[model samples]
Target: MQWNVQELENWEELRTYVDTALLPLYLYRPEKPVKEHVQRMSYLVQVAASIEQRLKGRVLMFPLCYQIGDEPLAQRLPAGFAHYVLLQFSGDRLDAHEGEGSRLRLTVGDEDLESALRFEVTIDVLSQEIIRHWQHGGRQ
Candidate 1:
């Protein structure tokens, strides 16, 4: 379930069914042009939505956390989650895939930026990877 007052009210009960919290971090360059920033944000939202749709009952998707240029992330995270997965999307690099600890970073590279179909496919594959990791009890 998405983060909201209604859902938050049932958080305790929801906790019983879900073991993982999925946080989507949208990282963008404040110095970039408006059009570029918007495009990147659009891609981030679409990818995040895709993940939420596929894993609706199993994971709780927190609201999008927008970060500007290396801003600290620790303070933005919600408390009480022992199994948390951070899915980060950045527009400034081609180093699209990286995973360590509980965070996975995907770059909105040229290929994904050029075609919506490719972008969706990339999101699907990444989402599946996350689900697989979670099902196997997360990282060791």
Candidate 2:
């Protein structure tokens, strides 16, 4: 399910299947051109939708978190989830590759955008990783 009014309205019945929350973290640079930003945003939505489609019943897809520089991460994640996965995307490479906790961060860069095959593979890997992490009780 997704984080929307329709889903929220059916929360009473839908809550049982939602054990994980999928949060897409988009890192944007204010100095970048509008075209570049739009491309990145498009990729983010595509990747996020792919994941949600694969894990429809088990995960709830939250809205994207647009952050600039070192802005604090979003803290308004809905309650009652057994696990949380934070997928990060940026135009430039990140310094730290990964992190620890109930949250898992998957970072993607320019190379992953070179071809449709590459993008599909990356999303598949991300979806699998999240499912694997959740199955293991979200121990990272």
lDDT top scorer: 2
- After TM-score superposition, the amount by which residue 39's alpha carbon in candidate 2 deviates from its true location, in angstroms, is 0.8
Off by over 4 Å in 1: 5-10, 74-76, 90-111
Model 1 earns a TM-score of: 0.72
- lDDT comparing candidate 2 with the true structure: 0.73
Per-model C-alpha RMSD: 4.6, 3.9
Candidates in order have lDDT scores of 0.64, 0.73
Q: Report the lDDT tens digits of candidate 1 across residue range 1-140.
A: 77778867887777877655676666667777989878776776667667777877766777767656765544344555545666665444222122233544444453447686797787778777877777666653
Native RMSD of candidate 2 (Å): 3.9
Off by more than 4 A, model 2: 6-9, 90-101, 112-114
User: Clash number for every model?
Assistant: 0, 0
Candidate 2's displacement at residue 1, Å, is 1.3
